[model samples]
Structure formats: structure tokens, C-alpha cells
Target chain A: MTPASLDLRPLFPAIVVAVTGLAVLLAQAFTPKGGRAPAAALSLAGLAGALVAVVVIAGGRGRGAVLATSVAADDFALFFQALILAIGIVAVLLSTSYLRETATDRGEYYALVLFAIVGMLGLVSALELVAVFVALEIMSVAVYALAGLQRDRPESQEAALKYFITGSFSSAFFLYGVALLYGLTGRTSLALIAQGLRAGGIAPAAAAAGVASAGAATALALVATALLLVGFGFKVASVPFHMWAPDAYEGAPTTVTALMAAGVKAAAFGAFLRVFLQALPSLAAHWQPAVAVLAIVTMIIGNLGALAQSNLKRMLAYSSVAHAGYLMTALVAAPGLGTEAILFYLVTYAAVNLGGFGAFAALTRSGREPVTLSDMAGLSERRPLLAAALTVFLVSLTGVPVSGGFVGKFYLFSAAVRAGYAHLAIIGMLMSVVSAYYYLRVVVAMYMEPPVGEDPWSRVGTGAALALTISTTVVLVLGVYPGPLMAWARAAAGSLR
Target chain B: MALFQAILCYVFGALALGAALVMVAQRNPTYSAFALIVTLVSLSAVFGLFGAPFIAALQIIVYAGAIMVLFLFVLMLLNVRTEVRAPGEGRVFKLVAIGLGALLVGEIGSVLVAARPALAGGFDASARQVARLLFDARYLYVFEATSILILASLVGAIALAKRDPSS
Candidate 1:
């Protein structure tokens, strides 16, 4: 509570995001017509600087710092901060061409994206329930608006509306859970709650308070847990709670969708891991079953759901949902391996999704949305490099050899197996197989189908193409040699507070 | 019989449940949104009766005040007047929504009832204690989070309202 005790170093990443966001806004204000490129460059530069700052501050292997009970700057936070910043960088790169083509190339677009990333970083680092809720709102509201940034596009508006309603409802559920939790434990900090729960049986005086004390506090805790689960489930787009994902993904600009699937989901998973693993560990036996069921349902539903989608973005959305299920399986199989598995899967998933979406962004021509599977036909014949890159991305998503997704899934299933949930792993793997069917379907259309008239791949900028190429290469590199990353993941997961 | 206290609890709980039901079944979204606000406010009152006065006040202030206003403004702006015209009309989807809604309600209900044993004596001077804790200890974080929320809102509002430059 002392001002001297407030270690501001832990807040550097968040401050960097905020300052960079402001810089982007100011640059947007000063920039003239046709100056979107410079604005985007500046935003990208700011994000890169923030990324560097986060690394430099949190780069050491130790727990960097803690800002009272509100935030922590440990390996877990640094990992997510890095992931979010990386996603922001890719989003900026994707948006450069996307905005230029759509003729909605406003400097503010990049600024909003940067601001969303700022929120995302805070969401990951926050250690208090209140702080997490506010960070989530900041992130969600920004993305909701960005989804409909192309206001003239009906689909964009529709995406934004659906996302906004569902998101608000989820926020209410999350806050209600927080309230219930506060009532039950008279606290909100995860660390304090964990300590309270473990101090030899719900406090001595609370026990003497008798029957009402036992039932009410326990009931409130359980309700809070369920609400929190639902809230996070919606954010991660798990099945049975994933209706908004496809519409939002398909309707939003591809870059925004990428940000949602990558940055937002990663942050949500971080919160999910932190809350359940930290505050509710004592109730693991009770909640693990619920999570297990959700995992199975999400995997099956997300994969089957993806089976019929023709739109690439919609398919990827379903794939993202299925991936959440897969990740949830790891979370459910919880002898502590769940945490590490989730961190690993999230890093791999971010790279793969960004790569896939980057490829899509590269294919999109001016005045035309290249979302349909048919629209991507004969890509290999027309734009060989882009087609090959997309193939790598899809193959990686399908868990093929030497791709990050493959290693990611391997880590998850292995973690589940280690937790004595081999059956869950089997079911998850089966769902992965089903997901591969849809992800590969896109690949087949890209290679097998004939070109529909003149290909517009020539219109894609070299920088955009380079981004896709780098993403694809990263996917493969991480897949083949994931040892270092896994080591980092293990350390980060262990540091869960 | 402790008539005043028991009667208050029953009355407030009944109002909360009633408003919640109205919120769920109402055809008009604006009306549904309004019903939701009422439910939230009454829930806050219920929390207040339970001695979590701060939570109750926050419930009314945060959810009912800021959140619902935003919801209602969007509803009015978007003119979501007709239930039938609401997006996602597929029968299967509706069925899923209903099923999920029922499950959520059931789960929460069961949990609440199960944990009912833990409730102790209601609020007795904890309001000032909690407030003091929040301000004296948690003020800086709250300030930071509030600033972030405001900035996000400002950016979001502008983004949502801006006209297309190309148009």
C-alpha cells in the first residue's frame, strides 16, 4: 500500500502499449492524405519498440516485478506480452494492404489496433479480478468497434453488432462472478484468494459461523466459477458458446479477425489459466469434470461446424474454436501440465493463425473480398509463392509434420496424457483429425481447382508477401525445433502465481 | 419472527427473479434491456441486504448505470425493434441458445443452493472497511484501469460513428 512499494517496472509493457497508441493517434492526426503508409509504419515501429522494451524488462529468466496485487511481470506475462505484440505487428502488416485496397485506409485504424493490443497486454498481466475485467472490456470494446470499422460494409456492421451483444453479455456474467467471488472470499486478488482458500479450512472464525457460512460461501464460489468459465469460454470461442466467432471473423476485415483469433484468444486463455489454476485450484476435482465435458463438446462441435463453411475466414474461425477445445482438453487434464500445454499451444496457434490469415490478406484484391474457397482456386498455378505459403500455413494448422501446430498438438496431448487423461487426449486427437479435413479442403481448392480468370496475386505488395513468408517459416521452424520454446513455456507455466 | 428482515429479503429476491424472467422472455430488445437493468438494480439491493453494500452499490452503478446505458444507446441507434428480425433465426441455433440458457440458469441455481451453507452474519460495518481498502490500497490500479477503459470507449465511439472517407 505504500507508494515506495509500488514497483512501476512491472507496468512497462502496458505503458509502452499506451504511449505507442498515443503516438499512433498523434501521427494519424498530423498525417495528410495518402499518408497512411507512414502512419502504419510509425505504429509498427512503436509496436516493435514496445516489444523490445517488454523483452528487455522481462527478458531475464526471473519473475520481473509485481505492481501491488493488480499486475505481475513474470515469465508468463512476458510470454503473452510478446505474443500479443507479435500479433499486433502482423496485424499492422496485414492492414497496410487491406486498408489500401478497401479504400478505408485511415491512420486511426492502425491506432485502434495498437490500442487493442495495449488492452490485450494488460489483460494478460493483470492479477486482480477487477483489473482483468476492465482490461477485458478495453480489449473487447476496441475489437468490437474495429470489427465494424468498414462502416459502409453491411457484413462489418453485422459482425460488430453480434460481437458487441454477446461480448457485453459475457462481461456481465464475468462481473457477476467477480461479485459473487468477492462476497464469498471478501477478496479479489488471485494470490490472496488462493492463500485464503488454502489456510487450513476456510478460516477458523468462518467455520464457527455455522451452517449458513458453509453453504453460502461454497455456493457463491461455485456459481462464480461457472460464470467465469462461461465468460472465458465465450471469449475463446469454444463450442456451444461460439456462434459469434464465424460471423465476426468473416465479417470483420481479415486483419482484425487475425487479431481477435490470435491476440484476444491468447489473452483470454491467459486469464483462464490464471484464474482457474490460481484462485480455484482447491475446487479442481469439481470443476475439472465440467471443463472436460466442455472440451469434448467444443472439439466435436467446432470441427463439425467447420466442415460446411465455404468462407475461409469462417472455416478458420471454426478451426480456432476447435483449437480452443483442444487447448481446453489440456486445461482439463490438470495435474499442472495443463498450464504449460496451454502456453505452448497458444504460441504455436498464434503463429499458425497469423500465417494463414496473412496469406489470405495477401490474396485479397482491391474492391474484392477473396473469402470463398472457390475464389482461392488455382492459387498454386497463378501465385506459386503465396500458394506455397498458404499450404504451409494450412498444413501446420492440420498438425502436419514439422509445423508449429503439429508440435503444439503433440505437447497438448502429451500433457493431457501425463495428467492421466489419455482418453481425453485420444478424443482430442480425433477432433484434430476432423479439423484437418476442413483445413485441408482449402488447400485442395487452392491447388486442384482451375483458375477462375485472371489471378490478382500480382497486386499484393512484397512487404505483405514477406510477412506471410516469415510467418510460414516461423511455423515450420518452431515445429521442427520447439525445445527452447517448450523450455520457456514450462518456466512460464511454473511461474503461474 | 424477525418480520422486517425476512420480509425484505423475500421481497427483494422476488423482485430480482421477476425482473430477470422479464428480461429473458421480453420480445423487444430495448424492453428486454430495460428489464435487465431492473434485474441488476434489484440484485444490487439483494446484495446490499446481504451486507455486501459496496457490491450492491457497484452493481447498480457499474452494470445498471454505465453498462446498461451503453446497451440501450446501441439498441436505440441500431433500432433493434423486432425480435423476429434479430440475427441468427435458424431453428437449430435458437434451440442451442435456449438449451445453453437453461443450462446456465440451472448450473448457477444449483451452485447457489449448494453453497448456501457458507453464508454467515450479514453486513455489519464492512462497507467502510471495504471502501477504505479499495481507496487506500487499490486506488492506483483502479485509476489506471479506469483511464484505460475511458480511452477504449473514446476510441470505440469514434470508430463506430466515423463516416467512410471513400464515401
Candidate 2:
């Protein structure tokens, strides 16, 4: 665990991303206009390589910290690395046609995507607070720019501004929390901090014997925990901190929104699980109730907000907030099952949400995006195959039987109930039911409502279609045969505990 | 020596506070920028008094030097000819903001008072010691990651600010 014996093997995936991002940037700078295809291909190759590295490393290693104990290259980190890499690849595929059509097929676009994945990988693996903050900024800054990529759009600019301001504000709170934690425990490493807390309850035994009062140290730790919660809650887009999600999701390009919902949320949850379950286990009595309340509020607000949205993007944004709530419920559950539930739900959610956004990206025309519910009215008649795919995604999101979302939610709620939170689980079930109304509304609009005008569907490219097919297949396969993925999740959960 | 250091700390602290107030109250963007620079410089002096010479140097070099220049450049780029004062709208906002600010200040003050008996005298670390700590294995990863963060921000700025010829 010493710094001098740091192993770089666990960092292979992040290195792949960083190197590819730089290469993409250089290629973009040198390449002629309209030659951005190679950049996309290069980015995809890099992500695929990183995914392979994750699988290989996962097979070869035991669970432990690496890079001088700054990062844990455990099954948890490997799982998130694989998930984020898959998300990046899918997002890149989905972005290809959108970029070409919008005349923004610059190499920098792919570079930013690769770089953001690097951040997410680092974030999931980060074992220290400073590392966590650094990785988070690496992701957030890139994403802020990605959100405002379309410089001509006022909404895009506004989304970037709001996201950046709120994101940085939350980061400040997180850093202050880290400072306070260090003050209390005299350690920056989460493991050491936990040991410090367990040894003397709050402050180190030696420090407690000195001038520092245990009460003040405990109070500082509580404040730090609250600040950390606010920072992370904002990242996962829970209620009260979710005002940016709708606008940011609605304004960004569909592919970027897909990455934000699938990749960013998963990465944040990975960190959330580690910091809470592993580092702050002693303070569960203090944090568990606060998290439960947050989960209930997030679910209610997110679903209710979605109910009022006519814009497909806005609705999905709210749905993302609700999904975060569902994941939070899993976190509030008993430790082992809760961890397993989160991993399983995140995988299914990545598939369902990406597929959902991919369908929208597929329908995007040359000069206009498919924003309104009316845009999907005659989708069934125009592009029946896409409409069918959207139906599967929507159905899965609604937690209907024979879909991945249903199984995921079932496990999440059952785990919560087993943890003796039946009331919270009941509220979760009701919210899921409420969520189905909006999800089904989309299906109903596509299949039942008549066309308002001529077909506005653009030609779906091979890349977009390929991404859709993969995500759809994942959702369906996981739904039907959940055994393998659940086993993987369980194994990953074991490493953390 | 301790008395002199204490006096220096109070002087810099007061100067920093006054500069901050001036920065906030100033209507003209250029004047506000100048006031901010003064505040940063004075804060650096306070840091020096606290025996964190490296941080003080960084505060002056990074915050007062590079960041303030960037701020002034942005203000000039935006070129607000006149300060637009919304009389009624700002009043409520200002009041609420001040109320929150006071509450935060009060909380911090109470916490400091509660921990006053436990407060230990500061031990100064030289710049070399600070460097060693930062470059050590425990922080090396984060330090390296910060470089990548800065790199990402640099790339992002260029990507956003650059105009697309196709557009």
C-alpha cells in the first residue's frame, strides 16, 4: 500500500482513454475537414481496448488498492470501468451520425468523450478524497463543455452555465467536507479515516487525550458527512439538487445526454457506495435515515415532475432522477444485498436509458431534433422497427414484467424491505407505478396517436442502429436470464464488503 | 516575534475583508476586478502570516496574477458599457443573500468558539516539506490527476471557444 510500490497495471484502462483522447485531439488538428470518421473509429478502438483490459485485469487480480492506495482496483472498480467503457462506446456510436448531420463531427468531440470516460474510470477507482475530487472535476469540466457543444443554441449555453455553476458550487462543499474530515481524523485516506474513527469513536485516541474534544470532532464529522451528501446528491441528481438535470439533459445532444444519464450516474453511485458502505459504516445510524428521506423525496419529485413534462428529453431527465432515487433505496438497504442491488440496477439502467436515448437520436432530422411528444406520434407508422425498439426501452423503464427494469426494481425494493424499510419500499413501489404512467404515455403516443404531419424521421445510420441493437439485446437478455449478471454483481459486492 | 506576527495577521485580515467588501460593492466591472486583486493579495499576506509561505506564493502567482488577469480579460471582452442596476429586484435578493451570509458567519463563529479550548498552536512547515508531502505517494496520484483535470479544462475551453467553419 506504500506509494513507492505503486502498481500501474490497474490503471491500464484509464491510460488507454487518456492516450486515445490525446491522439484523437492530435488527429483532429491535423486531419482535413470531413475526415472525422477516423477519429470516431480511433475512439471506438480505444474504448474497446480499455474494455478488454478491464476484463483481463478483473480475471487476474485480487481485490485491493493500487496506485499507492489512491485507487482500489477491486471488482467494484473493474465493474464500473467495464460499464463506463461500454457506455462510452455506445455513446460514441450514437454520436457519429448526430455529429455528421449537425456538421460538428470534429475530432475534439470524440476526444472529450474519451477524456470524460477517463475521469469516470478514475472516479470509480479513486480511494482517497483528493483523488475523488480531482477525478470528478475531470469529468464535470469536460461534460460542461459537451453540454454546450452546440455554441449556437441558447438553451445549450444556458445548460452549460447552470451545470458548471452548480457543479463547482457542490465541489466546493465537497472539498470543505474533506478538509473537515481530515481535521477530525488526521487522515485523508478513507481506510485510515475509518480506522481512526473506529479506534476512538471520532478523533484518534492520542489526539483525544490531547486538547481536541471528542464531541467537537464528532460534530465536525457529522457536518462533513452532510456536506459530502449534498455534493454527491447533486451529482446523482436527487430531488432538490435536480433542477439542472432537466434543462441540461434536454439541451445537450442526445448522445451526450445518454452518457450523462448512464455513465455519470453510475460513476457517482460507485463512489457513493464506496464512501458510505466502506468508509462511513460506523456512522450508518446517522446517514441511513437521511438517505431514506432523500430516496423517498427523489422518487416522488422525479416521477411527478416527469408526469408534467411533454418533452421527451425532459421526461427522461426526470426519469433519471427517479432512477437515482431507486438506486438510493438500494443503498439504504442492508449492506450486502444493497450493494448487489445497486450494481444490478445500474447495469440494467445503462442499457434501458441508453437505448431510449438512442432511439431518439435515431429519429433526429437534419435541422431539428425530436423534442416534443407530437414528434413521436406517428413513429410507429413511419419507422415501425424504431417504434418497436422504443417500446421495449419504455416498457423496461416502466418496470413491466419480462423487462430488465422490472427485475432491477423488484430486487431493489425487496432488498429494502429485507432491511426493515418496508415503508420506504412501499413508497418506492407506488412511485414506480406512478412512473409507468409517463413511460406508457410515450408508448401510447407512438402507437395510438395519429400522425400530425409528414414523416420527420431522418435516415438512421448503421452506427446508431448498431448501438440500439446492442443495448436492446442487453436489456432483453438480462431480463430473461438474469443469472449471470446477478452473479457478477454479487461477486463485485463481495469485494467491497 | 509572536506579537509582531499577531499584529501582521490582524492587519492583513482587515485589509482582506475591506477589499472583499469593496469588490462586492463596486458597480463597475473594472473596479471590482481591481478590488478582487487587492483582496487576493491581502489574503496571500494572511497565509504568509500563518506560515504557509508556499500557499501564499501560490495565492499571489495563481490567483492574483493569472486568474485576475483572466477575469479582467473576460470583463473587457463582455464590455458592459454601464452597470445595470435593478433597484427593486436586487433589493430582495440582496437582503436574502445577506441573511444567509450572516447565518453562515454565525455558525462558523459558534463552532470556532466551541473548539477554542482545543485549539493548538500552529506548527509551520517549510516550503520544502510542503513539496515533499505533495509529491509523496499518498498524494502523488491526486496531484497527477489534477494535471489531467487542468488539461481537460484547457481542451474544453478551446473546444467551446473555437468557431466551427461549417457553422
Candidate 3:
């Protein structure tokens, strides 16, 4: 239990981010009212330290488990840790201006965001089910409260309630699945469970007599995967389980929505891919088709749903759902090109999503977000830089050429096609085509339509501007020259054992 | 001693089943809470008969004591009078659920009886074992990390719930 016995260098990134969260709370509590607490700057510094740690430990130290195998620090975890931290940094930057403008600039926002990032960092690395469950809860609870950060607004409260209630139900389903897996395999560690399931026997250290027979284990594994899918499905906001996302996204603060759209989905997908591939690959013949079916329905339904939304946030919510479908398609082809595609696509998706929402959060719209497409009407004539950035994001979302979204979609669909899931790729391509209409409508409104009012648009703030710039640059760089990142993604994706 | 333990197990098991049925069938919320408590206490007794005193104590302390008290207090405080029922809440599904529940109970009972010998051979479930694992195992890190989660949640709850005069 002593620090000397454990090689904790790999866990340093999560520790840095988590400690900074507490520090943010401390600074917030001690600071005098009406005085700046430097919460944003402190979190950014911590995130930078974490990012550097991820790079420094990218070698031999991060390739194994620590803390008695409750969690891992493998290349896969490091890759996602880096991505999650990067997303946090950009999110914090965006939130600085977003909170100040909305008059909800409480210091807890940064601390909560940092905590959520810590959860995500733990989530991708966790090797044990209890750790996964706790990390998931940590991430979920923070976001649940964050969904209601604007306490004065009834919609935010409703969003929080809906999200929390649904989240708890999903967690119950997940825990039940975990219990079943433990009962059947008599192990709690994911790798051990997979070993037990594959060997068709109780794991060596367990009391084998209490465990079910091999035939029964398969049956229980099927049910467990179904239940686990329900849990992960809700988190990723896939179809039939995604009724809450539109409302929550529409009601929550725009920057938080950005993180929800980008970071949460990425983290959940990381866990989903790992759990399925690592712990339940033996059941893939059954689960793969289930995931494929979910992907097909999610892609079709999500695009169709987004077509009906007029509000900017709700549309992105549905679009994120559709993107979840696209990502799930990669799961069907995993342990190979599919894994690489997912790694590449998540970054592109995160960048474009953050860029799109960051552009919206850039301007103070009278203490609230501008909701309708017309809110961006003639935005090229007003904030030209923002208008251009938004256009790029929208274009990227539409998967057009010369954008990150285009390259990501190409890589993902090609991988799906190569993996004999050509049908999924075809359906995904068609839905993405269908998505072009709504996405471009916003772009058209921004560029072609007349201004809505005589009042001048507010200038974009510095922090938000920086956030948007970084996101947009990531999107563009990945679009044009994705060589370096592609190699990194290849290395990370191949490391899963 | 074996005969006595077996008899005790059967008595508490039967009592638990009877109390549970009463809890579900009772119309009054207050009576239902009492019945639930009876069921939980009996269940705890059953656990104690099964040589799991820690779990038995936890069952009584957590579910029967603390949670039931809160349930009763909330029911009394709210002063609820109406029957807690949804109008036309699908009886067919309820019947199906009850039937499936019984089936599951039978299956689990059979499995437990069959696996009693294997389970009896497992390592000690003593408090010392749990404490050692909590500290000696890496679960200590998980325990520590969970605090941050709790603290963050507490902060969030306060931030969202508290009234601000400035606003």
C-alpha cells in the first residue's frame, strides 16, 4: 500500500488534474467575493502538467498495470488520457468566457470540469469493474450537476433531473451485468473475466463450484453484454436510449454541451470498445451484430431526428448521436483498422464539435445562447472570423472535403468497408449525406441571410477565441496533414491486448 | 448444532418470504414500511445463520435501521394519504414480472443449495480480511479517489441548491 511499492508515475496525469480540482475548490472558497480566484488559469496549468506527464510517460513506464491491477497505464490509456486532457484544456478555456458572459462564473464550474476529466482519465485506464463503475459515477455526477449549473433556469433543472434519473437506471443495469459476469466467471478484473470466459472455466483463483457451467456462462455473458450495452449506449447517446440528449444539450450551458458532445462520448466509447474487445471478444459473434444493429438504427434515426430540430444545440445533440453511431461502426471492425479509425475519428469529431460550439460560446448573447439558425444570419457581415470558423465546423460535420470530419469519415467508413461491414458504411454514408441539408442550412443562414436586428454583435472574447482557434486548427490540420497523428493513433490502437 | 442452524435458517427464510409478501400486498404505506423492515430483519437473521455476521449486521444497520427510518420519516413528513398507484398501470406486465420473479427465486435457491459446499471452502469473510484488502490491496487508491467524487458531488449539490442573493 505504500507509495514505494507502486510505480505511480503513469497515474501522475490523473493525480495532477484531480489535485488541481481540489485546489480550485479551495481557491474558490477562500477568495473574497467579487474578486477573481484564478480558477481557470490554475486548472489550465494543471492540465498542462498532465499533458506533459502523458508525453513523458509515453514510453516503458505506461505499458503496465498499477494499483494492484485496478487500473492500467497502457499506451491505449495514455492516448485517451492525452485526448481527454486536451479536450479539458480547450473546454476550460471556452468556459472562462462562457461562464463570465452567462453570469454563472462560479469557481465550482472549473473544479467540477476538472473532476469530470479526472473521471474520464480513470475510466479509460481502469482494469477492474469497481474502478470503472466508480470512475463512471464520478464523471456522471459532475455532469449531472453541471447540466443544472444555471439553477435559476427551470429547463436546466429539468435537464439535470432527467439526466440523473436515466443515468442511475443505466448504472443499475450496468452493475447488475457486472454482478452476473462476476458470478459466472468468478473474477472482477476485465482481463481475468475474458480469460475465464474464453477458457470456458472458472478463473484459477476463484471458488469454481459456485460458478455456473460453461454453457450457462455463455448465456449469462449474452445477457451481461446486453445490459452493459444499455449502460454504455445511454452514456454515448445512441438510438432508442438517446431521448434525453436533445433536451439536456439544449438546456445546459453551451460550453458544457461542447464537452458533453466531444469528451463524454469519446470516454464512453473508449470504455465500450475496451470492455467488448478485451473482456467479451469470445461473445463477439452475438455482440457484434447487436452493435451493428444499434449502429444502423442509430445512424438512420439520429440523422432523421436532427433534421427536425430548429435549435442549434438540439441539432448538434442529434448529430452527436449520429456520430456515436459512426463510432460504434468501428467497434464491429475492432482490433484492427477499425480501432485506428475510431482513434482518428474521435479526435476529428471532438475538434469539429468543440470548434462549432466554441464559436457559439465566443460571443455573449445577452446572458444566453443564440438558439436559432437565424441567430447566425449574416454573421459573415458581422463577426467574420467566427462566421468563417463556424462554416468550417459545419462543413466538417457535413464531411465535405478539406476538413477533419471528411478525413475521419473517410478513414472510418473505409475501415468498416474493409472489415466486411460494407453495409454499415453504405448506410452511414447515406445518412451523412442526408445530414448535409441541415448542417448546410446553418451555414447558408450565416453567410447568405440578412442581419436580424440593428444591434451590433458582441466581440468574441480572448479565451474563447483561443479555444476556437485551437479546435479549428486541430480540425484543419487533421484534415490536411493527418500523417503524424495517424501514426500515433495506429500505435495506440495496436496496443490493446 | 447443525440441526439447530438448519431449523433457524428455515424459520427466518420463511418469515422473510411471508413479510415480503405482506409488504407488497399492504395498502397502507406505513404498514408496508413495517413489513419491509420485518422482511429485512429476517433476511439478516438468515445471513447470520449462514455464518455471515458482518453482512447480517450491515443488512440490519443499513437497510432495516437507517434506510427504513428515513423511509418512514419521509412518509410521515409528506403526510401522504392516497394509494401510490398509477391509473391503469398495466396489470398484465405486473403479473408477468411476479411470475418471472418467482421463477428466478426458485432458480437461485436451487443454485445456492447446490453450491453450498464450494462456497463454504472460500477464504474468510472476517472484518480483518476486508480491512487488510482495503489497505494492502490497491483498493486503497480507489477508496481515496472516491472521496474526490463525493467532494465534487457535494460541491455541485450545494452550488445548484443554494440560494444566491446576488442573483
Candidate 4:
């Protein structure tokens, strides 16, 4: 398709999110105080409409380079659009009750959530470097605000400041990397860059021999790749760049934390997969080993960090980091079944992490932090359903059989092994064993330990319960019957090239 | 004409550097802010010397004008007292600052010299050309996305900074 005649039919989901975000903002302005329920209802309706649009578009013929070749409407992008929209719906549901309990239930919260989803949808579809950067910034700015949503909490403010500062630093690096890549290949479009590299149009030797020499150009490209890696690394909360994740996750509202752990990480991985596997596949020999090492380090460090955490939020934060490592292993093995593996893992991971956080949100009441291990003491006695749900989630997180996480991990490790990275898979399995300690620790705290004091069995709002139930159902279904989703994921992965 | 441009570039560049030095040297926040304005204005002048008048104007309007004003207002609102440094502390800071500054200058000088052959031709940075390119399909997405980003930031700022009446 020509750029001039770029079709926008595939952008229906993103357009829905953008319009819904603005409508929510306008509604917020017009709605009276204590009308948070209506605003939330409106947001939910908008997300459901977006979800419908995603399904319809996915059923249509997948295409490439929509909106003037800036974004692709391929199945890969559609998969992420659907995943992010689903996650956004659940997050909004969780937020409705949590915000109400905390007395921060303003319409702006829902509006921001919609805007963040717009960013994610755009990010997954963006085919050009400039568009990627813009979408990245859009997502980052919205999340930064969400991280600091609790105005009265000093920890929240600190979280926002730290995330914003570090996030901006990474953006700068990413921008510089884009500049260097453009200089090397004279193109910003991912497909064109790949074509140029494959055709020897931007040969390293030719670049080295030129005025700046082939060495300089090649060096620039390498530096650019490193910078982009750092940028994506920070977003996915990989080991060395993950210092902000624990604090940010711990400080944000539980619902927001769920969104960060599930939606944001998935979106980041979506971008990472597209950029590294689609655009720079020619340079896989250089990047694959580096990424594999990062995966190993991240897996070990994230699990070890979680083992030392007394707070449940902090432990989950570290757990999210460890999961990022697992996903990265798939990326490192991208030439094989890595792409499909990562997609399956992301779907499972999103469901389990969101469900885990949703359970935590259900237990949280206004004006109190019930996140400590002791705070969870005898949780089974207090709230049997929540405890049971949390148990399921934790079990899934530990990759136990009969859960979605197990299937996801099996796919990822087998993909690595099939790709001749059995060592990585071995390390990954060992780390999964190490992770079980912390995941089961929470279960033990809930089931075996006696109550520290009053059970703190506050009522679970309908919205939160719905979110938790949906997440739990997704986890269980994917675990039991992974056929349909695996087929979709494989198709989506095939469309990437 | 080329000779005149070169002279103008050196003058404005030196002024910018001097202003930056003064900004960092000032102990009082207000004075530091004023020095920052000077640096921004001088940088704009340097941009003008490079034949980017539009960017120069934007530098003044956005950075030296609005941003500096905001900085000054925040400084005044906070009313932070001037910090008193211990004798060796300030000395050590100055020494480290000077060393870093020297290293930065050396790096820049080497890069410029090495890249001189590649910089033989200069591209036009006229407003009309920049506008045409920016409005082209290739860049239009980024431009629109940037607007969305700014809007999101505005919403976030208000959401975080505004006080809750219920609280």
C-alpha cells in the first residue's frame, strides 16, 4: 500500500481510546462531585467498545504500514492492542473501588488510565522510530502522573520524581540512539532500515571508509543499539536498570501497580519485540548474546531481591522483574520459537500478575497499608475467597503445574533449549525454583500463620471482585486450554516479519 | 560574510559559556536563575549565528522567557535560604567542576576536529524549510504525538499539584 493511501481501519481501537480519553476528561469537568461511579461506568463502556473494535479489526485482513507508514496494522500490533485493552479494562475495574475507598475517586484517574492505554496501543503499532519515541513518551508521562496519584503520600511523590527523572534519562538515550541509527542508515522506518542493512546500502565497511569512516558509522550504530537497549531495558525493569520498579510499584495505588505490572510491561515488551526482532534482526548475532546475559542476570537478581522483601508489594515488584527476565529469554531466542513463546508468556504473565495485584487491591482499605507479610497473617480466615485467589495467583507465579505460568514458562524454556540455549533454560529453571520460596512464603503466611490482630476483613467492592474473577478465570483457562491462544500468538508472531 | 558569521558565532558562544559558568557559581538561587536566563539568551544568539533564526526565536520565547519565569517564580515561592558551604567543601566542588568542564571542552574540541571533513556542507535551517519538513507525512505523526504528550503532562501536573478539597 502506498503511504498516500494509508488505511486507518486498523487504527479503530486506538482512535476509540483517544476519543474515550478526551470524553472522559470532558465528563470529569461536567460531572458533579461524588459522581465517580458514572465516570467509571463511562470509562468501562469506552474500553469495552475499544475491545470490540480490536476483535473486529483482528478478524479483518492484517496489513502493514497504516497512517502514512508510521504504524503497522499487522496481527502483532493487533494482539498487543487487544491485550492492552483487556488489561486496561481490568485495571479500570480495580481502580473504581480502590479510588473510592481511598477517597481519590476523581474522574481524572479514569481519564489518565484511558490516555495511558492510548499510548500503549500506539506504541505497539508504531513502525517508525519517531513514532516509537512519541508513543513511549506518551505512555511514560501518563504513568509518571499515575505513580504520583496519591498526592498526600510522600512516598508516592518520591516514586513519581524518581520514575520521571530516570525515565527521561532513558528517553534521551533512546533519542540519541535513534539519531545515530538514522545517521547510519538514513532511514527511520523500521522496514526500510532492515532493507537497507540487508542490501548493504549502509554497510559497516563502507561507513568506516567514508569521511567519518566505516568504523565511526558502525560504532554509531552499535552505540545506538546499546542506547535503545538501555531505554527498553529500563521500561521492562530488567536487572541493572530496575532499581525504580520496586519503589514505583510499592508507592503507586494498588490498581495502578497492577496496570504497571501487567499493561505497561506488556506494552514495553511489544515495542522491544518489534524493534529488536523486526527491525534489527540482521544484527541478532551482536545483540542476542548481550540480551541472553541480561536475561540470566535479571532472573537471578530479581528472584534474590524478592526473597529478601518483607512487604508483599515489594516482593511482587521484584517478581515482576524476574518475569521480565523470562520474557527477555524469548527475545534472545527470537530466531526460533522465541517470538511466539514471548507472546504466550506475556498473555499468561499479564493475567496472573494482574490477578495477584487485584487480590492485593481487594484486601487494601482506605487510609492503611496492609502489605506487610504479617498484615497477611491468617488472611484465609478473614477473607477466604481472596486468600484462595491469591493462592492461585502465587501458585501460577511460581510456575506450578495446572496454572498458566507453568505453561508459559515451559514454552519459554523449551524455546530457549530448542534454540541451543539450554544453559539459559537451565538457569531459568533454577531461578524459577528460587522464586517459589517467596511465592509460597506468602501462601504460608496466609494459610498457616495466626492472625496478628483483627482480621481487617473489609468488604470487597463489586468492581474489584469482577476484575479479580476475570483475571483468575483467564489464568485458569489459559492453563487448561492453551490451544486457541497459542494459535493466535503464533499467527501474530509470524506476522512480525 | 562568512568571516563576520564566524566572529559572531565565537562571541555568542563565549558569552553562553560564561553565563553558564556564572549560573553554576552563584550561591543564591535567584542569581543563579538570572544567570541561566543569560545563558539561554546567549545560546539563542549562537543559534541565530548558525542561520536558524526560528530556533533562536523559540529559544528566547520558550526557554529564556517562559521557562525562566517559571523557575524564578518557583524559587521565590519556595524562598529557600542560601546554602552555607564549609571551607573545603566548596573548594572540592569547584575543583571537580573545573575538571569536568575541562574534560567536556577537550572532548568537544576533538570531535569537532575529527568531524571537520564531514561537516563541509551546511544544510538550510530556514523556517519555511523546517515547517515543510515537519508538516510532511514522515514527521507529522511525531509532531501530533508530541502534542498529546504535552497535554498528558498538563493533565498530570494539575492532577498531582492541585489540592483535594475533601482532604
| lDDT for each candidate structure | 0.82, 0.86, 0.86, 0.85
Clash pairs of candidate 3? Answer: none
Worst 10 residues of 1 chain A by lDDT: A203-212
Q: Tell me the tens digit of each residue's lDDT in model 4 across B114-156.
A: 6544532466888888998888876776787787788788888
lDDT of 1: 0.82
**Per-residue lDDT of candidate 2, residues A191-266 (tens digit):** 8878876665455433643426667567667888999999999999998889999999988878889999999999
Tens-digit lDDT track for model 1 on B43-76?
8877877778878888988999999999999999
Cα error, candidate 3, residue A124 (Å): 0.7
Candidate order by decreasing DockQ:
3, 2, 4, 1
**Chain B TM-score, one value per candidate, order as shown:** 0.70, 0.84, 0.82, 0.80
**Interface RMSD, one decimal, each candidate:** 3.3, 3.2, 2.3, 3.3
**lDDT of model 2, residue B131:** 84
* Candidate order by decreasing lDDT: 2, 3, 4, 1
Candidate 3 chain A — worst ten consecutive residues by lDDT sum? A203-212
lDDT of 1 by residue, A1-497 (tens): 67777777767777877777777787777777745537777877888888888888765643568887688888889889988898888778877887777766776677678778878888888888988888898889889988988887899999999999999999999999987776556678887776765543254444443324555566667888899999999999987889999999988888888889989999999988888888888778878989889988998898888898888889999989988999998998654677887888888788788878877776677757778888889888888887888888888888887889888888889888888778889998887787788888888998999998766653668668666766877788888999988888888887884
List ranges where model 4 is wrong by over 4 Å. Answer: A1-6, A33-37, A61-65, A198-211, A450-453, B1-32, B35-39, B79-92, B117-122
| Structure candidate 4, residue pairs in collision | A207-A213, A207-A214, A208-A213, A208-A214, A208-A215, A209-A214
- Give TM-scores for every candidate, taking all chains together and pairing residue i with residue i: 0.82, 0.92, 0.93, 0.93
Classified by CAPRI criteria, candidate 2 counts as medium
Q: Model 4, range A18-86, lDDT digits (tens) per residue?
A: 788888888777767655437787888899999898787777664443677787788899888989999
